[model samples]
Target: MTETQIWALVFVALTFSVYIYIAWRSRVRETRGFFVAEQNVPAIANGAAVAADWMSAASFISMAGLIAFLGSDGSVYLMGWTGGYVLLALLLAPYLRKWGKFTVPEFVGDRFSETVRSVAAVVAIIVSFTYVVGQMAGGGIVFSRFLEIPQAGGVAIAAAVIFTYAVFGGMKGITWTQVAQYTVMIVAYLIPAWAVAHTITGIPVPQVSFGRILEELNALQAEFGLDQYTQAFTARPQLDVFLVTMALMIGTAGLPHVIIRFYTTKSVRGSRWSALWALVFIALLYTTAPAVGAFTKFNLLQGVQGQPVDALPQWVQNWQATGLVSVSESADTITSITNKATVFADGGADLLVNNDILVLASPEIAGLPAPIVGLVAAGGLAAAMSTAAGLLLVISSSVSHDLYFRYVDHHASEARRLGVSRIAMGLAVLVAIYFGINPPAFVAQVVAFAFGLAASTFFPLLVLGVFWKRTNAAGAVSGMLAGLAFTGSYMIHTLEVFGTSAHEYVFGISPEGIGTLGAVVNLVVTIVVSLATRPPSHEVQEMVEQIRYPAEREEVGAN
Candidate 1:
């Protein structure tokens, strides 16, 4: 590590300190406080917290890296994440908050039926665990890269820290801590992206510079005999893929962890304001990633040409020491491993160049010193931790609200419920740590899976449930199950069961984006099933109306 790297570490450490301090100071005592920060959070603060928690490692580390490698094709994530927020502001947040529940499972149960609520609880746990594992893995990647530790060791350290804050403090603690984490992650993501952009095209605003880079990228592709790659996608009508994107856009509004954030707001208006705040905060990083990606790609093509395959710049060397970057050793090995030849150290560098490292490798490609690289590591960690904490809250509440209060002990005191929540939180952290050590998948890839699942399973039901008066419990359950089953089975057969070398793709659409089909099947099944079943009861229809309007309705009307 260089002199600059030491200072970057200091800044990152200071950021962590601030998160701990703020979270500790904000610890809440009541069950409501633990669940929703006692509903006392200001709109701006809650928004920041939501944004920080929502933008995970994939947003910080993986998306840029994906963009760096995929060029214009990478805008999927930019669109997916941002589109989710728009859906939130336009459709989900206001109604969800007006429903006035601390946990999404609780709302689902109340809205549809106890059975539907029970099913939603299962889905929430799966979604949160799957998503949070990615966050924890991302944290491990940051730790490995910056702290010069083994991947498992790094994951352990991060898990320990996440556990300390999430278990002890609850939502009140996690909420304020997320606000601090938001500042760290956004600054870390933007500053380096800005520096890289200025160096590449002399532009201070990364969004503009990124556009310029894309122009040059188009030219570069023409030079590299890759004009077809650039032009091929245009002519390629990915109908199924288009469907997946639709599902994702619909799904974003319904994610349980994301939905729960609205409950922290003191009022319906505050929820609206928080959504806007999240959008603003998210925009800072999203706007910059395209630039960072193009610049990194350009620099990589320049830096790594024809050298000894293992030769990397100082920062690259440092990252290798840290382990954020992975490689397969031979072209044949990559061919054998297919596109995912991402495992490092055991003869993979010559075999494959992981696209995941593109952002982490940016400084090295540009010959920037280690300190900037270190800062990137810190940024990645902030993103992971912030999102992980938010997910943990959701997971904890799944047990506390859905199972404990609903079935285990309907009369359990609030304090007893809180204690159960802490236990659940601790268990969630343990599960996250387990996945982090033995990573099940790529950071961005895993997140995409979660999104697709959300799109197919959660989004359709929530949207229909909220807006379509005819959508009933039978439809919701059938839709969610069909979406989940179709997506999972199709992806496994198409992506994993069939090898990439054999060209195992379903109509050339990736598993990462294919759930769009599942979503459609879900909607169709839901419609069919609802038609087959009776309309929801009067009380359920009335519940829908309560969430739709802003004016205060009678308490009798609310239930």
Candidate 2:
């Protein structure tokens, strides 16, 4: 095997072995343990696990790429996701933790009616499945590029590994494994970024050097007659950027897998603390992403623009083998004895570099050592696998715990429930694998769709359910259905799915941003319908008050 491949194999084996060991050590048998890690995880460890779970392949592998391609517009993801986490911690996490349910659907069931619970459960499943497909696609990318395997083969292998640890170890195992993953991915991400920053600008700190790099990149882009590197709204409309940012922010607050992390903590305060810790850890990478994006883009332009096809860098040739990148001779291929002005613009057109490969190829592009390249490959896999495990667990719990056990057999034994969860997880893996092999969009884009769905369908219900006591079953159900229908239909219409051509976006909102409008629609419908219908039962109202203020439960009981 090649040096990069060998190093990658070694790193991958070591990391996978560590994950399996953690899963084995932390395996659970009971339902509580499976669903919420027995609610005994310490705040710091749970924080790390939460970070690992939240920063999936999209964050680790694709976010920088998005930034690289979209320029300043990509700041929306960084801002929306970070801001959304704040919203979740302040607005939802503490209250959800106080509610102390095994799953989101369980909270809905207790707060509303059985019918609403079922609907929430189905919605949770759909959102989780949609999210998992992105993770699988990302993992597939890492495997395909590093392991020299086909994307489909890579996806199947990732599915089997996820099934092994996630199904057998459940939430308990997934939490500990995620902690390790966070460590791996962060270290892997920072090392290359630091090296590249130092190499380019003599500053090892990416956050500091990226500013200098951006100036250089803008000059280079201008010379090539391309849009400036710091330009915004060039790739997407201004309205879409705002709506997409809002959708991602609210959606982060609403994702089932992320919300469920709070339930794994010992107390509501633990959940809050964990959220704070997760933000700190996540910020480490988010802060560095722009630096990495600028550095990689500058490197690509400088290294490849005027290079001969036969004399291209080994890294470019290597990636080209994967068919994600391509270079072709243009009419001016033989007349390339020119300055930078004529290269990117007039001579041979630029190489078709896929954004998804930017981060993975950055180390190689910068001529970093093989070990760093392999470490990045391993880190990408960790990011993808860690999030995929969390998502799969969410799907399993929603289906088995919320739908089957709650609806099918109230008296089902723990063992039987666990069996059903494993089977559901296996089935979910199959579905994820299929979609992974045939993803509808890029990793970050597909994930954005998931966030949109979550924002529209669950954010309004959860917020209104906790903060507004008068939100009855009718209002909750109506709001969820309306929001989901609107968002789902918009996405289906705007996205080229199932061989259908995309229609014009409504009001200039792209599929990625439509969820914000859908959420608005949901909130309006929910308020109007709640006012029209009778308020919830006195008991349910009391329950809502208790969720909002735990001390009130004892006061109400005494009264």
RMSD of each: 4.2, 3.5
The pairs that clash in candidate 2 are none
lDDT of 2 by residue, 218-315 (tens): 88776656677798887678998999899999999999999999999998888889999989988999999988998998887788665666777788
How good is model 1 by TM-score?
0.90
Q: Which ten residues in a row have the lowest lDDT in candidate 2?
A: 332-341
> What's the CA RMSD of model 2 in angstroms?
3.5
Q: Model 1, which residues run further than 4 Å from truth?
A: 1-5, 222-237, 306-312, 322-351, 497-503, 553-559
Scored by CA lDDT, what does every candidate get? Answer: 0.75, 0.87
User: So what's the TM-score on candidate 2?
Assistant: 0.95
Residue 490 C-alpha lDDT in model 1: 65
Q: For each candidate, how many residue pairs have backbone atoms clashing (under 3 Å)?
A: 17, 0
